[model samples]
Target: MDNSQRIVTIKDIAQELKLSVSTVSRALRDSAEIKLETKMLVKEVAARLHYTPNPIALSLKEKRSKIIGVIVPEIANNFSSNTIAGIEDIAYKKGYHVLIFQSHEKYEREKENVQLLVSRRIDGLIISLANETQCYDHLTDTIDKNIPLVMFDRVCHSINAHKVITNDYFGAYNGVEHLIQQGYHNIALITLPLNLSITQNRLNGYKDAMKKYNLPVRDEWIIHSPIDVVCSEMTIRRILESDNRPDAIFISAERLNIICIKVIKEMGLRIPEDIAIAGFSDNPITPYLAPALTSVKQPTFNVGQKAAELIIELIENNNTTTQYRTIQLDTALDIQASSRRRQ
Candidate 1:
């Protein structure tokens, strides 16, 4: 390519201002050594020329890709999407790029994405575990390599890494307590695979709430539903069809909650009359529904922001992640018509 067609660089800006490349670089970075007037002039000229730093050159010089990798079970979900939006907002301000990958809730796929990100020399990683992930060896390998990593939403507790999560135990406790107060005695808990920490946390919450009110905790009521439409529908139907059908259903997360809502409508069940529904979701769609859903609202944006900040901290400041921090944020119970039992 001819000089005219080449991308403008710091050297171009320096030549345009009749200054050395180092002077232009320091001035652009606003170094104290460079005069304020010189820095101002350099920035004005750089902006006019639309000069952009070459990422490849920057990576080589700084020993960092200036890119952060994000892996989640599914990007299509509103919760995951909001978290990613928060992550990007912070990354952009900090002069870093984001690379996203969806694991599709497959353990193998998550492993492959992690490996690919490492191969690309990502400066850090922020992730949520896939539903089928049983072994955290791939993630352990990442930390063994001293790569900064932060886990959020769906996470493996045994792993030593910075994690951002909602208070699942209390969130579920509040949802179930609300149901009990509404006079729903037979409340079923629909959950993702029991392997997930969230599922277990929510399950315990339901059990504890039932015990608190002197209610029977039926073993059959806790349905371990996967994040699949067909599978969840069939399994949920089986539980509902049973003679011991529940008066209420508290789903573990948004994905399963959506499926449960569809299944309930298909069976022509009335909200809070035939069955009351409550679960975890901060998605706006809940409020717009005919009988707005009762849900536990997690801090999606805050969790994302905190996770990104932690990863960036580990990346830039070389913070020792061995002393891992598990930041558990609060959740709010959004009461609505779905679980508003009649007197």
Candidate 2:
């Protein structure tokens, strides 16, 4: 490339304005050292020249980017999509751009994505960790780098970071309690892997509700299913075909609810007749499903709103004192035919 094609810099702006590099830089940033007239002049000239501040140079000088990185376990899911939209809305309004990355629900993928975003000189990071993530090496890396990070939904307990989550324990407990109240003594829990903290909370809630009501809690009644609809369908089908069929099932996660219904339909079972179901889901589709799925509706919109607010706070505050913050929202059970008692 010719020398004329070289990128513009603060020095170039200084030379054009016949001022020192420090003066030009200060003027560009509107620092108090520069006069109001000089600041306006420098800014106008820089804008006219279409000068773009190099993030690398700015990061080296200012120690942070104005942009925030957002990582989701899977962007395809409704909950993630909605949460991301909320983050974007807040980030954009606060004069920050969001760089979104999908982890595909894999630990290695999540680790790689976090590292890559950090490499891009982001000011802060917001993440909903993957279910498969068990270790905290990558999350701890953020702390070591003095970067502010906030975790939403699936979070790490070992690492002390800011977290925003729904009340999965109460949500699951209330869901199960509602089912028991409706005469569902034999209740099963359709859930994600118990290794995840969110899953464990919901499962604990289930156990607590059963114990409180003096209902039998069978170990085999807990069925862990894959995120895939087909795989979940097959797993639920196996459970349904077993000799010890549950009278009602508490879906631990909303995504698993979709496949559970298909499995119920395949068995030619009448909902609330042969079996009853209640799921943890925040999707609008729940109210429209066949039998209008009774579900534990997570405050999805609020979760998104709060996640964005926390990330914004982290970025603006820039105080990385290793303070652990956890925000837990409430969830409501939407009653429908699935968990209704027989007349």
Candidate 3:
């Protein structure tokens, strides 16, 4: 009679009420086959006994855990955090739970997390690829196993999974064009490695904008830096210190924008006076900077919400013939003092 040490089960309820285990299960699930009186009695007994269904057992029986896994590069970033909030909002309302994992931009860690989530039999997965991820065997393996997966933000083009992303090319193009409109001819670009699709698209936009305005794209002005802060700082310093320095800078990443600003301050350069700046960001702090930065703000929350909706639909449909989709959302330009030239 040690209630603290013993857990209640369907068998326990059945034995106490002198009913079959199947009857207890059916009643608990509110099946139409069970009489109303029996269903009410079983629910009352289950509540009184503090009985809870085991998720593992139920998943094994129904082949669904009603849980989805999410993987992001880093949750501390404002963009990632906002996206996660949107995902949670939709997932909660749909009667599902979300399990999150941070890849820290490491390829091995991302692989491990995907494997762990798959082993746990999650209904589906939502992922943003790590910066260091060059090979995508783990992602393809999930598809081979017939598990629904959705990739958002930083995704793999080789994978045919459903995707949600912003218009990186147009965002960068508009940002660079804003600088051009502000009468800054020599515009520099600080971007991530070209291997990434986002990086490539944004870079192409910058080039196209420069070409559109009949401005020459200098080789040295197009600097490629890793996602590391230290590396970005060094690269920014070298660019600013050079004799043929640019009058305006276009940063392609959020973190790189912060680094560029820090470097500018350390060198005692005034914003929009010495050099104007613009970048990609959705951080609230953008408007509060010493000279508020002009930025291309992607629809971070909508991206996450749409990704969750797609994955859940795929999970619920479980139809092998269902066609996948890639949803690309728009970005807005938030113009401010940083990128404006003082007349």
Candidate 4:
């Protein structure tokens, strides 16, 4: 017989060993009721036959696939990639597999990814909502179906689920405070749309810090630009060309920070000498910039680890009645040459 013609099964092993199919099954699973000798014999025969357990069949029987789905806005960013690494590390240790999906900051894509992951019968889901995702119907549907869900980073507060996030308010406050301590009074802010929770928190922090130092909060200096390179460049140019140009700028997003730097350099402005800058970033390249960037770094990896842990716990317990949790991790400020005044 051709070796690849037919797949080996427990029934075939049972017939060859003169044992019942149930006995073979128990032996293969190493059930406590099965004898040690029988289990060993079954393993050896299964190995020789090149038999493999079918995950599909097992999932149908146990009602679990042992796979978790993860959705992020984009995987190319340093933050998302670092978070995924942390999640994979924990999931691997716990014997669960991860399926990743990227939404590319589109609302429709985010919804579609959720549906696909659900159709695969994943044990649970971990998500960081896209900037364009405002609808909660798809998310609520997962809860109705009793599938565990955890949200991290960009999340919706209306959805009742386990959430892991950074202390954006304090992180932003620290960044702006550092600028003030360095004698930057006329500070500007480049941020995302006001609809996002992270943006709101960070904006509040910036405002509070300026108020604390009695610095004028110029409304014109605050530019609300999405994560578009063209829009960011235009907005930044307007701020730089204005008659009351800021002496320092605080960017809320890492990508925006990079754009701000590019704009500053293109305008023949020298870092710290002409204008100082600070923002939120975790890119390793921050330290190697023309003037090493000063910025706030969140515990991105830890956020992913905690999100995975929570989702797995919810899956294993299947405890619908248990209260959901929201975890907020701390952030750190890395002060570099970019934000300091020239001696």
Per-model C-alpha lDDT, please?
Answer: 0.90, 0.85, 0.91, 0.90
Regarding TM-score, does 2 or 3 come out ahead?
Answer: 3
Please write out the lDDT profile of model 2 over residues 1-343, one tens digit for every residue: 8997567788778888999999999898889988999998888888878788888988788766778888988887778888888888777888888899998889999999999998897888888888788887998898788788888888877777878898999999999999999998999999988778889899999999999999888988898888677777888898899998988899888678878888888889989899999998768887787898898877766777777777777777774454678999888889987888855
**Each model's TM-score?**
0.84, 0.86, 0.89, 0.87
Ranking by lDDT: 3, 4, 1, 2
Most lDDT-accurate candidate: 3
TM-score, candidate number 2 = 0.86
Which residue runs of candidate 2 sit more than 4 Å off their true CA positions? 1-50
224, model 4: CA deviation in Å?
2.2
Q: Which stretches of candidate 3 lie over 4 Å from their true place?
A: 1-49, 319-322
lDDT by residue (1-343, candidate 3, tens digit) is 7875488899989998999999999999889999999999999999999998988989988979999999998998878998999899899999999999999989999999999999999999999988888899999999998899999988888798998999999999999999999999999999987777788889999999999999999999999888778988999999999998899999998878878989999999999899999999989899999899999999999998999999899988882535778899999999999987647
Clashing pairs in 1: none
| Error in Å for residue 228 of model 1 | 2.3
Q: In model 3, what are the clashing residue pairs, if there are any?
A: none
Cα lDDT of candidate 4 equals: 0.90
Worst 10 residues of 2 by lDDT: 315-324
lDDT of 1 by residue, 171-199 (tens): 99999999999989898988889888888
Candidates 3 and 4 compared by TM-score, better number: 3
